[model samples]
Target: MTRKTTNSLEEVHESVAIVQNTSIWKKILAFFGPAYMVSVGYMDPGNWATDIAGGSQFGYKLIWVLLMSNIMALLLQSLSARLGIVRQRDLAQASRDTYSRPVNMVLYLLAEIAIAACDLAEVLGMAIGLQLLFDIPLLWGVSITMLDTFLLLFLLNKGIRKMEAFIIALIAIIGLSFLIEMFLAKPDVTEIARGLIPSIPDSTALYIAIGIIGATVMPHNLYLHSSLVQTRKFDRSKKGIKQAIRYNFLDSFLALNMAFFVNAAILILAAAAFYKNGMHEVAEIQDAHRLLEPLLGTHWASILFAVALIAAGQSSTITGTLAGQIVMEGYLNLRIQPWVRRIITRLIAIVPALVAIIYFGEAATGKLLLLSQVILSLQLGFAIIPLIHFVSDKTKMQGFAIGKWTKIASWLIALIIVTLNAKLVFDEIETWVTTSENPIYIWLFVVPIAIFAAFLLLYIIIKPFVEKNRTIPNLVPHINEIVVSESNEPIVYSKIAIALDFSKTDQKSIASALQLGGKTAHYTIIHVVETVGAMVHGNETHDYETTSDHYYLEEYQKALEARGYQVSSILDFGSPKKSIAKVVNENDFDILVLGAHGHNWFKDLLLGTTVDAVRHKITIPLLVVKDH
Candidate 1:
């Protein structure tokens, strides 16, 4: 059966496999990659800033916030993973399918802001790491990170498994770096227990606590985890889906708990090394890096810390780029090339960090990082509300949803996130009013904007269930002219070349081409075998793309021959796009006809739509028959 149109990387859907009769360990192993990809977000440089800030200021008192946020992350991420598994849609694609255009546009904007906010954190972290490690100037370090877009493109072209492995390796480096430093820092056991007792300590401490939560349970993580879980191939049977969800939860729990340790380790290390000695303002990464060696009396402490910082920054940004593509494609229904998308995101993130370093100086970036987290925290409701709404609805999820208590618990987490983030904003405004020289000027700009943001958030939360979305089909043909063709019609072309990806069970293009070419026309149906993930890793799949294409081509050949037309089916493996072009160029063909699946107008442009790619490579005349 053809999978439903979800436009969110359907090309890569079920690309990874799970052995049917494998032992539980092997099954769980198969589900392990997505969460590791997700876990990279949790222990990013943003976590370091908040955790260190909290630790240095309140002496581990905000550990409770970190712990609480992790629990919330575990629940929400579980919901997201389940949403993808069951609905067969990521948050973006799912939202687009169900919401009104205006609502979806607003969400798309919020998602863009959230991605940018998250990227800013990652970029600044990378720059700080560079400063610490190579003694590079912060300005240059920030500028240098723009090139990582190319690195992300390389890893992406390598395939998902290599990408996951790369992220895991970075996580290990960060973990090992901290593990070594944690021992040297020698944190107190009793104070840590007291910190876990759930007291806010003070309002200022509460501000940092909110940041800790934001850093731990990122908004983008919720979206990213949901999308990532669908990559694995599994039985679509009820029992099989249930099993996949169970293993996926296990994967998220174990990986996020590991993230918990790294984030906690950051705070604990900062608390032990700095706070006890009265260094409260050691919030920036470089500041902490400078103090680590002197405070711990170990030569390697700062070095490991810097190396880990670099690793965390780099790893987090790689996934951040992927998350951007997912959100854009899922919502806008168009995906730019991996490298182009990354450059766009990385550029938006880099400019701010670069300015913060050069104009405001390195010390000011600590505030920028905190502001980024707060912005992330503010946008959490926009993401969390829809995620919870989609998964909780019986219409959307049917039988495969969280139970009543789990739903209540998920809402409670959302409520807590909303309340805490609101308080953080309110408290910041209060502080600014009390402390700033130009309070009136700031308020003039901030209050209305804040009100607008809150109103929008409230509307988004309620709009989905409250309003009946005006349903619009994905395509509306402009039918200004009509033509009828008979069997006696003149032959349009002597020979035709048709390239198909078998994205759908589409026969409209073939019929149209046949009618245009008349019964005497000869056609070549071509399929190409791509080196999907086998470029870097040997663990490529059952050659599903090629096999599926061959099966579809056989059916096409049979149908064509039965209609009294001569047809040949060709399957060429390796570099499928190039192969399509080579065949078209080498052969004497009057016209190349390609079946185009209409998504948005820009879908072909962004998605590397097979037709768009093959069209450029061949000088032959082309007709793009559309099936939306």
Candidate 2:
């Protein structure tokens, strides 16, 4: 019976294998297509509207936001790329696995809502751009955009590279249109140069500047860029990985630099055309275009502005769709049909936008843009904090982690963003409660609520360390006893083991092992216990599994495979110390590598059973990687 079942399974697997093998190009293309689609989010029409508004209102006073945002973009994109490359998974997916279920659900819901909000802006921008270009009704234009689903499917089927090339072409057209507009307007080059210098005009301008920064960097783009990096199917060799990282950085830098220039051009053009003339009445994206008609010749200016808006809207929509996919896949681990996700996101976004449009009529454009930027600003912290923590953790990254200066810069940027958003939320609430004519008894309700929220945030910031301390003490010998080992043997083995539960220090240990080579050395990865405690034991299982031998072994094998290394794995149910020693002795391993602090070691050492057991029982060299 078992043989017959095995044969049936093999037959099914073979059939699927044949299908997958036949579509190698299709699979490769699928990976390449998403990044270009995702890149559009950076240069979306909503961003154009904000950039133009910022320029028209403040006249290059807000240029610093663009500069700062691009820098932030670079740092965040690098983190995203590293996450994808090192973990072989998207950020959302990682979060779902790492975080508590409640935390995961909350994050997923927030991200999903955020993505939907973003899609609304893209869809609205596209519909409006269409209306502007073709003199179609806004509602009709919106209805027409429903066809994007079919378009997306058709493009995906053709090949991702084809889609990327097409998007790049559109971007070029948009870039050219902006360049022509900038040259035609011919703003004072000196004034444009001055815009590059940083100075805050006022508190209100500061807030608006922050808004622009938030708008430009965006939360969804982080998810998109990381997932996009995975499309390269990067070679894991040291040199190859390094090269992949280099090219990725270059790609991101180029893409974002173009985004910077495009954003700056909009602002500079507006400043040159409208600001110098003391015209601050421009509200809508279309208004910015109309403002250009009087300054530059009407025919060329209107046409260029319309075309650029169209390009921005279409390109951004494509990216927004892709971002939605990454967020869904990463956070939920649900590979829902792409069209379903797209349509759901589009519908959510469009309903709010349509309501705003219907209610406010022409005034809705600026409000829609502002609302989108504000939502992005609010959601920034959720993504940014995780990014900072993950990248800065040396344990997770091994040698390919973020540098100290980069971490400092990342933290500073994240702090500034959090502060700005906090300030915005506070000010908005203050205005609503204190200054409004109908001063609600709700002030009694609002103050404590605000205080509680602040406390909650403070707690979350320190929660990881607090929890760590509560659960386990450091297992490393005192610093005084941690003398660097002096060895005559040339270190030949560099082994790295990756696991979901291991701390950053564990990652560093793996890196250290790799650095310390051994003669004919091989890195052995083992995951001993595979079955989840909930499935195997019951609700009594602690958050941190003491019996993760199978889990570790499986992950170790996977990491080895990812690095193109052959590894021997061991799975055992009993004491990890005994098992490890037996494996080491049997395999003739020269060195034993283990996390300085782990499940069995703590209890075993306390009971005087662990280190002694390994030291006496195993003949191989032992390396304990210390975690910071």
Candidate 3:
């Protein structure tokens, strides 16, 4: 039996058309947007705080960290894109297939938390930007950020390309804003060069450096990038996969470096405008924004800072929401409306942000933002480790698996992230234990959770090595051996029912029905009026729509009869699914043939597809034919 592989990002999978025979540059253009989507996560509002903190406290000392993080991001993201392109699975979907149900639940939960943490930072960043630029109250600004959830829905409704265009535009604003800021707050070149050389001056610097790395190499971006790359329609053949992997590598390199420039510029701007002026404690985004104009002797400095902050926060929002949808669907094999999924994630992030702002005051946002980054860091290992294992597996990746050197490099990067994140987590838990008023709560709550997480992490790592031949669930079709035989017996349907939408697909449906039942068998052509009067009055309705639809049915019947085929027509009123199912079941048609509408998941979900509903309601075999 033939089965269709369910593509990730079902609505937009292979949505962007790539001209395979085009010039290399043209092909590159088609593969460009996914990486941009991933890159925005690197320079999001979470990174801004860390970058600002690093630059203000240590001057140009941590620029190397940003550079290192960007390199790591590009490497891991390339692997992610490769997985999506070659294996046709996102990180989450891949994880679901590898791990059992309970384990997948744990993995899915962690991913959701990481995304929520990331979104929390975005919400606070957006609120802070509004507070800085428009003097809007922080509370009101955060509430205002909720409205953009709908805005994102609107942009996505347009298309992935449109969404990508929106993100690119925001990224441009961020890049341009910082470019001007860099000019205004000219720093010592010699100092920046020194920062290129790695050195953690002190423990405080080390902490900030880890924060920079954590904020830059986001966990959710891995899930987002892997799924996003599948948006481009590319050839799945060896040559096409090679081209996709190559172009995506270039995409990650350029886009992430632009993120590096944005982040490094943030650090450099803070160094020049604050660190040089002895304002080493300017760690908060608001503090950085407040001091920018005075320190640089220009109001545009502060204005651009706020503008960039807003852009970063807003752009990151779109990807975070998308990641939430990806993880939930990929891990659970459960799909929901994108808007509902997005709002649910946004609300999850919003509640905590609102609580922190309302209770702890607006000043607490910076600490909350840092805490969110830490949560993301804690989840990083889980995402990265699985991705490396999946992409490294020869059986899964086939010819596209990483080479020895690339595999070694990928593991080394994973080791670095895991080590740093472990340290970050330990340091944080220690701090909480030492400083909290109720230290017993840390041991009772945080420590056990940490131990549980550690064990869970260990399980995923060791399972692959121990159980080498564990079967992957049939989540997608693969080339493998199966029992096959040829049957000599001929089969035929005595009676066939064809459902028509009266569009171009009606011809296809009629043809499919004829093929199924043949010229000798009975055929019933079905069409539902579905007019307002028809829905209200059913067969009692008398209107132009009903009369016209009846005539169309007669024409179809007469044409089939002239072709020397046994054909009849049914024109019913009210709902299509119910009417068609009733007609098919009541008449005991041997087979039901209908034209496939070929709508994406979103449309089928929101508007409802007739084929699915009818299939469930009817007892007859359904053959859905696609329109050519």
- Count clashing residue pairs per candidate: 0, 25, 0
Tens digits of lDDT, candidate 2, 1-628: 0000011001011111112243545434323333445556767777776777778788977787888888888778878877766655567765654566677677777677677667767777777777777887777766776776667667655544556787888888888998999888888877777878888787767666766776787888887776666545334667656765665666677777887888888888878888878886564787776667778976788788888777877777766766776676566655334566667656666677677667877557766776787678777777877766666556556578788888888889888888887887788788888777765655767667666546545544555444432322232222222223324466565442321123345455555555565323456654332223323333343322333434444554565445544555554333445655666676756576665444365444333344456677776667765565
Model 3 Cα lDDT, one tens digit per residue, 1-628: 1222345776666667788888989999989999999999998999998898899999999999999988888888998999988888899988987888999999999998888889889989998998898899989988988887898788766778999999999999999999999999988999999999999998788778877877988999999999999878677678988988999999999999999999999999999988998989988999988888888899999999999999999999878888888888899876556677778777877887888888999877887887787678778889988988888888879789899998899889878877877777788899998889999988999899888988998898888777767876543212121102222333388788888766667666676666666667888888887654566568986554566667667767776776677888888887887898888888978889888766678757754688888989987789998865
Between prediction 1 and prediction 3, the one with superior TM-score is 1
lDDT tens readout by residue for model 1, 1-628? 2322433454455667889887889888888889988998899888888998999998978888888889999998999999988987899887887676787888888888888888889988888899888889878887888778888777656666788888899999998989899889889998888888888878878778777777878888877888888888788788999998999999999999989999999999999999999999899887898898989998799999999989999999888877887887788776456556667777767776777677887778788888788788888888888898888877657688688999899889989889887887787788888999989976899877778878887886777678544353533121111112326668879898877655441455565677778778888888665544332232343544445556657776776676677899777655556777888899999898777777565665555667667878998798888776
- lDDT of every model, 2 decimals: 0.79, 0.64, 0.83
Q: Report residue 94 deviation for candidate 3 (angstroms).
A: 0.3
Steric clash pairs (candidate 1): none
TM-score, per-candidate, Cα-based: 0.84, 0.68, 0.79
Which segments of candidate 2 are over 4 A away from where they belong? 1-38, 441-460, 463-628
Candidate 1 whole-model C-alpha lDDT, 0 to 1? 0.79
Best by lDDT: 3
- Model 1, C-alpha of 294: deviation from truth (Å): 2.0
Which scores better on TM-score, 1 or 2? 1
